[model samples]
Target: MDTEMTSEGVAFAKQMLADDHAAEAMGIRLVRAGIGSATLAMAVTASMVNGHRMTHGGFVFALADTAFAVACNSYGRTTVASGGAITYLESTALGDELIAEAVERTRRGRSGVYDVTVRRGDDVVAEFRGNSREVRPRA
Candidate 1:
C-alpha cells in the first residue's frame, strides 16, 4: 500500500469533506487518506434500509462513490467521476458498520481509475470501480 500523501492533499481532502453536506449528513467519517487512497466508514441506519429489510444498494453505492471521490481528489487536483459502477455481493441490514476503502489503480494525464471495496467487518459487501477526469482550471 503506497501511503505517501502530500500535506496539501490531506488539507484539500479535509476541506472538501467540510463542504460536502451530503457526506456529512450520511455520517460518513474519514478513516484515513493518502495521495491516491482513502478509507471511509458509515453505519447503516434505519433510513437506509430498503423494503426487503436490507441496506439499500444506493446507499452502499454512495458510500463507495464517496470513498472513490476522496481518493481520486487526494492528488491536489480537481477530479470528478466520469463514470462508476458497483457490484453488490452481500446484503447488509441496519446497524451494520460498513467500511469502504479506495485505492488508485492507475493514472495518466487527466484520467484515472480507482477501485473501492465496501466491507462489513471481514465480509465483502460490494466492489466499485470509478473512472475519473481531472478538471482544468479556467484561465
Candidate 2:
C-alpha cells in the first residue's frame, strides 16, 4: 500500500489479502497498490521447485494471478478472474525473489483486462494476461 492509493484501494487490498490464505501460505507480500495497478513479491522456496530443480510453472502463475486479482479489485469491487494465460520466458530456481507487477489494460462495464509480468531481479520470467469480471453484490 502507498500513500497515493485511495482509501477504497487500501481497504479493498487489506480485505482481499486477509482472506487470501493461499497467497499468505506461499509467502506473497503486497509491495504497492493503486487504483488500477498492484505489485507483489514472492520468494521461491524448496517446495516450489519441480523435479527438474526449477521453479514450477504453477507457482509462477499463481504469483502473477494474485497480482492480477489485486490490481483488478483495487477499485473496491469484488473482481474474479474469468480466465488467464501465462507465457514462461525463463526458468527460475530456489532462493530467487520473484516480483509480479500488474497493470490494468482496459475496463468496459463489468469486464476488465490486466497484465502481469513476473521478474527475477531484472530478468523477466513470465508474462500473464488475465480477464476479470466484477461481481455485483446481491441486493
Candidate 3:
C-alpha cells in the first residue's frame, strides 16, 4: 500500500470532501489511499441509478473525481482540479462496487496531472485524466 492514503491520508480526504457539500450529498466514501495512489468506493443507491437500474455515469465520475482530489492533495497541500474528462468503458449495476485508482503524472510549476481508473471488480468502468492547480503558500 502507498502512504498517501494512510490513516492520516484518509482523514485529510474526509475533511476535504466534508467541506464540499455536493460531494457529501453524493455519499462519496474514502475507501483506501496511499501517497500517490488512492481507491474509493460508492454504493449505487436509487439517486445514483439510471433508467436501466445501472449506476449513472455522473456517480462514477464523482467517485473518481474525489479520488483524484485525495491523491493530488495527499502531500499536505491543496490542489484544485483545473480541467479534465472521463471515458466510460463499461456499465455497472446498482449493487456493483466501483473502485477508483489514481496516480500523479507530473507537476511542473503550479500544475499537475493525475490518471484515475474506475472499475467494477475486474472490469473497467471509466478512466479520468485530471489537471490540477497547485496551492501556493499563503502570503
Q: Could you tell me the TM-score of candidate 1?
A: 0.93
Model number with the top TM-score: 2
Error of 1 at 27 (Å): 0.6
Top candidate when judged by lDDT against the true structure:
2
Q: How high is each candidate's TM-score?
A: 0.93, 0.94, 0.83
Which ranges of candidate 3 are over 4 A from the true structure? 1-11, 136-139
What is the lDDT, from 0 to 100, of the residue 105 in candidate 3?
90
How many pairs of residues collide in model 2?
0
Q: What clash count goes with each model?
A: 0, 0, 5
- lDDT (tens digit, per residue) of candidate 3 on 68-133: 998887766677899989999898886777778888899887788999999888988899999988
Q: Which of 2 and 3 is the better model by lDDT? A: 2
**All models, RMSD in angstroms:** 2.7, 1.7, 3.1
Candidate 2's residue-wise lDDT over 1-139, tens digit each? Answer: 4424676865696579778999999999888888888899999999999999999999999999999998998888888999999999999999999999999999999999999999999999999999999998557
lDDT of 2 at 21: 99
Q: Which stretches of candidate 1 lie over 4 Å from their true place?
A: 1-5, 137-139
Taken over the whole model, the C-alpha lDDT of each candidate is 0.90, 0.91, 0.79
Model 1 weakest 10-residue run by lDDT = 1-10
